[model samples]
Target: MTGSLWRRALAEALGTGLLVTVVVGSGIAAAELSPGDTGLQLLENAFATALGLAVLILMLGPVSGAHFNPVVSAVDCWFGQRHGGGLAVRDLAAYVPAQVLGAIAGAVLANLMFGEQAVSWSTSDRSAGHLWIGETVATAGLILLIFSLARSGRSAAAPAAVGAYIGAAYWFTSSTSFANPAVTIGRAFSDTFAGIAPGSVPGFVVFQVIGAVVGAVLVLVLYPTAGDAADEVVVPHTESGVTS
Candidate 1:
């Protein structure tokens, strides 16, 4: 990777790592604090994740577009190609691995911080047709929302809007909106409140991809010039500029 790509990849790794840390750590804390109250536990986890995600986007969106999710990165690449202004295939290669690695590290760090064993494969089996449907819906909505904001020149609201959307999806979707493949894989490593069973990761990822495709279609239909706004999704940034 080039020097600029390296920096962007590092930002992606660090931002994604920290995002997972907040997710897993808050989940552990929520479970411990709420004990048997699943509702309260979820509330706590959702609140923390929403706020943390917003902050992460604001902080790193200028760098690497804060695309901590592979689905998002892939979609950005696809849309960006239309205008020759989004991430290149090589950037995608660098970004996916970095995001995945960061997510794993974040999960491990959260586990250790909570005095739990690192790398514990989760036992939470989330396999179900309904849950799969939920994943698709969640992901599709996420993709539509982010890209729509860009197309409408409303990228400035992405931080709070994306965060709020995920937070809401957690309650509305049976799958709790694990719309991110990297996050899904990372959460598989922790047998905690936020974890998903390893066996479930593949299904979630597949549905997420399907949802992304659906969402991209929606963007094209709704905003024919959406490709022109490709570099604006999630946030705006350039190779040498402080934009995210």
Candidate 2:
């Protein structure tokens, strides 16, 4: 395998593992420690989840573009940067399993340490109203934020920005702003404080995908190249794609 591929895989696994762990762990801490007040629980745990995501993105982005989420990866593939294949087949490699396992591990850890068992959703079954809207808003913000950082070559700060967006999104967006489809779906399996109900995962993911598409479209329209003054990120694919 190419070194790039290995690096990407490692980044995906390690970065996602740490990210999920923080999300699940801190959420649990909030639930068990805060208890009665849902708002307090979410508020207290938001920081660590954000910080952890920030750190992981900084560590893994240059390696694997720090996709961490399948939606990010899928979009990359769609735009011709990532190697595309059957969604079901390709996801098995590193993207899907890693994310799922990471989420599960995070949930288990949260349960063991903090005793959280479920994430608060806008509604039961994730039926696409509030959750879909929240996911879209949150994801659009996240992808746009990513585009800004990646193009500007300020990739190092991407994680922190992402973390801040997500942390703030908790209070700002309904459905706790589960912007990443992979994360939204995976969280369903858990019964911990961070868990979304198993049945509701699909709607959250669909909305996230829609939001990311919107964000990416805006990026394409604005930049259309690498050296464009309009673009803040300098992702590898954009180097030869164009120059503003």
Candidate 3:
């Protein structure tokens, strides 16, 4: 993590902001383009998200490890501290806030772009036991995929693998796979097809956190001797004397 903290944080913020922009904006566009066809709309939205996430990760991997999600950052920090080559606690502190703020800004930007109020709280009530379970499963699987890649030194595949996984999870999980906490909060600002009601956020976040814990435990159990130097969410590079 040789990149300056400010630089890394900026990359996280920008990357996350753009990620949310793609998500909410695409959802809006999908709904508009595919009117009554829920399946088509989902397909459209999922494709956009998968492609966009892959590109973002590739673009920002060297800058901040592209940890747009808080759970990823936390897990990275925990692993890095134990193995001596991951994010520091201070880095985690900086990354989470940046990711959250960027996510909010992205949502607002999406709303404004779609000709809606900037801060319209969503009315979509996604509060149900089944939905919570879906979120938990979605998030847990995401963590497992990411950390497992790190453990196996296959981080280069993350862009495609992660993208593909999320695309699949969107359909497999009932809650449409809002596996990211930052993204969850961001969605609360939009009252569109992708938005989640503010009231339902807490439960979703709690479940996601539980899912993260479950994923970490699974990692330990499944890969008992996995290296501590698990790959960052984004693969770092040093081609021009810059690193993350």
| RMSD of each candidate relative to the true structure | 1.1, 5.8, 2.1
Instruction: Give candidate 2's error at residue 163 in angstroms.
Output: 1.3
What is the RMSD, in Å, between candidate 3 and the native fold over all Cα? 2.1
Give the poorly placed runs of model 2, Cα more than 4 Å off: 1-4, 81-93, 114-125, 226-244
Best by lDDT: 1
**Residue 135 CA error for candidate 1 (Å)?**
0.4
Per-residue error for 134 in candidate 3, Å, reads 0.7
Off by over 4 Å in 3: 1-3, 237-244
Instruction: Please name the candidate that would achieve the greatest TM-score relative to the true structure.
Output: 1
Point out the higher-scoring one by lDDT: 2 or 3. 3
lDDT string, candidate 2, 1-244, tens digits: 3454555565566666666667767776787788899878888878778878777766555555567786666555554442222122343366656765666555555455554444333223556587688888888877777666665676556666778888899889888877876666556655667777767877777788899898778767765542232222312222222223
Write down the TM-score of every candidate.
Answer: 0.98, 0.78, 0.94
Model 1: ten consecutive residues of lowest lDDT? 235-244
Candidate 1 per-residue lDDT, tens place, 100-158, comes to 99999999999999999988999999999999999999999999999999999999999
Top-down TM-score ranking: 1, 3, 2
Query: What TM-score does candidate 2 get on C-alpha atoms?
Result: 0.78
Worst lDDT window (10 residues) for model 3? 232-241
User: Which residue pairs overlap in candidate 3's backbone?
Assistant: none
